[model samples]
Target: MQEEAYHIPVLLAECLEALQIDPAGTYVDCTFGGGGHSRAILDKLGPDGRLVAFDQDADAAQNLPDDPRVLFVPHNFRHLQRFLRLHKINSVNGVLADLGVSSHQFDEAERGFSIRFDADLDMRMDARSERTAAQLLQTYSEQQLHKLFEQYGEVTNARTLAKTIVTLRATMPMQTIQQFKAAIQGVVKGNPNKYLAQVFQALRIEVNDEMGALKQLLEQLPEVLVQGGRAAIITFHSLEDRLVKQFFKQGSFEPEEDHPFENKKQVSLLKVITKKPIVPTMEEQKRNSRSRSAKLRVAERI
Candidate 1:
């Protein structure tokens, strides 16, 4: 595996602007991928300012900042609240989270995050994590597989695909990306690239329990942020973006119910700063195509 940083830090400038850095204040970067955003945040902070970065992947520790103002936490961002409290931090000026698999994770073929490369079926972002994609495939029932394929992968033939997996697992355990691909070749409808990518994405998400982790992290944001503190999140998928959007706008995951007898008081702990998400500029897309789908949503604590 490459030891140096591998991620390009999509929409770098936009993220910085959304964060609205305070030179004397403290900040937390929940996803310290390749340290790109962390470095940027540090640049905008003063000598007294502090930056606490968190990355679950042990490999990411190599890129830790050397300055005393920066603190590195080798744990999942889902533990944001517990860790923050440990540092005697009740609130922060800004928080940034660039969610999803980092470029470094995708570049390493052995990590098994991308479909472009032939690698092991292990898709754990944190190598120490117990579950692998293969184990998940082997253990998940047909109905569970169907739900994952349909909800996460958006595969059109989820039912047939799940049924096929159940049949194949009876004879053999799907252990590698190549093996999984080969086993499901019969159900790949059209456009191999698109179909395979979706399947791999679904597996990766499940292996990492990404959505669950993200929800846990988001839930802590309200309590961890001070009044007017900012949280700038960059989500790459519709599901994540929608969750962030809804939370920032309405203060809760579920839609609000109308009450005729009472005035609608805002339950929201955050004020959505971005009426709509900020997308990468065309110039940025040309420079770093990985940023094309990046969506930035900023919110201020209420």
Candidate 2:
């Protein structure tokens, strides 16, 4: 499949500007979904510049560009530090991570990323992973399901939905998206599409351990980036946006209380560049609806 057809890069110009790329600098595209962002970065680089791109999805490998300047790593960005070291790279001038599902994953029905498709309940970004959405639905306790739905999906009737799944799955195993949707048909609130989307979002997050991976990626940024190096992240939902916002602002995930020694030394490793996240313009949003929810946050290493 063509790269563009796989996934359209969100906030291309904004992300590039945020990175402030230097002609000969080394950069990392932490999530090289379809190589759109990586290609653009490559365009701005001189012959001496290098780009390292990461994607766990095997499908993305076909879209890899044939450029000596670009080193494609078939691994998850969660292990960014380890992979970079293996490549003899200690630090980078900038890093770009576009978080969330790629368009190809959602479009491919068998992946079970989109509620629009009726396929197997398999939502593993890396197909090699053990757990699938079906496995999660079958094994997670009621309380675990409730927490996942409420916290990750923000489903209004999470408790009731979790209970319903627990009761139904006892007799009918939900191995397919259709079966899962049928199981939850009674509890769907508001628009059916919206509700199912939320449920699927929660499952995908858990199956991929996305939040945990994002935390690991964020934690390693300061160490991976050189002084004045930038990190540009595009998040599809508020959960991710909040984490990036907090980390960039305070160098911690949780809010810090004022202390007597607050000003004694610098605690923040990153200085937030975008006071507010940069959203796509009206034109760009119209061009690609998936870009509508994207929030691009840029930060610089202090």
Candidate 3:
């Protein structure tokens, strides 16, 4: 068997601590990339305790634990509630989600997740998925591309970037990372690699519907967690962290509505456990540059 690719867990100690582990309690690792967090949760679990893990990437299935106590669900974390129910689990004691593309996904150049490497324009986290970055570039309207780049990537020149793609794709589709990079040659600012990296990141986010999937995952948190059960979410981008932070605080994407007496009713779903996000230690950041962007937030069921 081929060795399973690995992703170094970010904020390892902090996540283990934030979980406030009950060795006899059941827990869930919603994003089991490389099984790092799942391994930790299992290590802390007693014989009676159970750990269920989920990952959309088929590549991660290799990391699934052989222990009977650890159940691996080969699906997206967005389907948390349904899968938990199917497994006969009504509610869990704790849930942990390490969101965004895994390091292994980026390191494998053929996945086209990293602009630093030349590869196909395929950025689907789940290979079974039909949509690829090139397909999105081929079909998405210029306005749609603009919105995707601006909203997902926070790209400063999204308008021009979108126009550039549409203009270039008219003659030939931007199918490879090299072609796409060449197309955007003029707009690249500061460092070429960094600028292309941001553009590729934007495309990958759009292709995967990452924000949509994240919203779905957040919506199901209230349903999956038992009373007092905590959820630890590790987000690598401001966009993902903002949604997690806001939902934990307000319980929904929409603003809390006022009652008849003009008082806003308290959202009973979750109590934000972390007033501020937990960040990586200086040592971890130095050892792994990927750890620098991670932000971990914890919340508990009310």
Maximum-TM-score candidate: 2
Query: Tens digits of per-residue lDDT for model 1 on 24-112?
Result: 99999999878888998899999999999999998788887679999888999999989988989888999999995788888888888
Ranking by TM-score: 2, 1, 3
Q: Rank the candidates by lDDT, best first.
A: 2, 1, 3
Model 2 Cα displacement at 140 (Å)? 0.4
Q: Which segments of candidate 3 are over 4 A away from where they belong?
A: 1-5, 256-261
Report the error of model 3 at residue 129, Å.
Answer: 0.9
Q: Model-by-model lDDT, in order?
A: 0.88, 0.93, 0.86
Give the clash count for each candidate: 0, 0, 0
List, residue by residue over 1-302, the lDDT tens digit for candidate 2. 78889999999999999999999999999889888999999999999999999999999889888889999899999999999999999999999999968999999988888888888999999989999999999999999999999999999999999999999998886999999888889999999999999998999999999999999999999999999999999999999999999888888776677688665433789999999999999999999998989999999998
Candidate 2 stretches with Cα past 4 Å from truth are 259-266
> What TM-score does prediction 3 earn?
0.95
After superposition on all C-alphas, the RMSD of every candidate to the true structure, in Å, is: 1.8, 1.4, 2.0
Error of 2 at 57 (Å): 0.3
Relative to the unseen true structure, what is the C-alpha lDDT of residue 190 in candidate 1, on a scale of 0 to 100? 91
Q: Which regions in candidate 1 have their CA more than 4 angstroms from the true location?
A: 1-5, 259-266
Pairs clashing within candidate 3: none
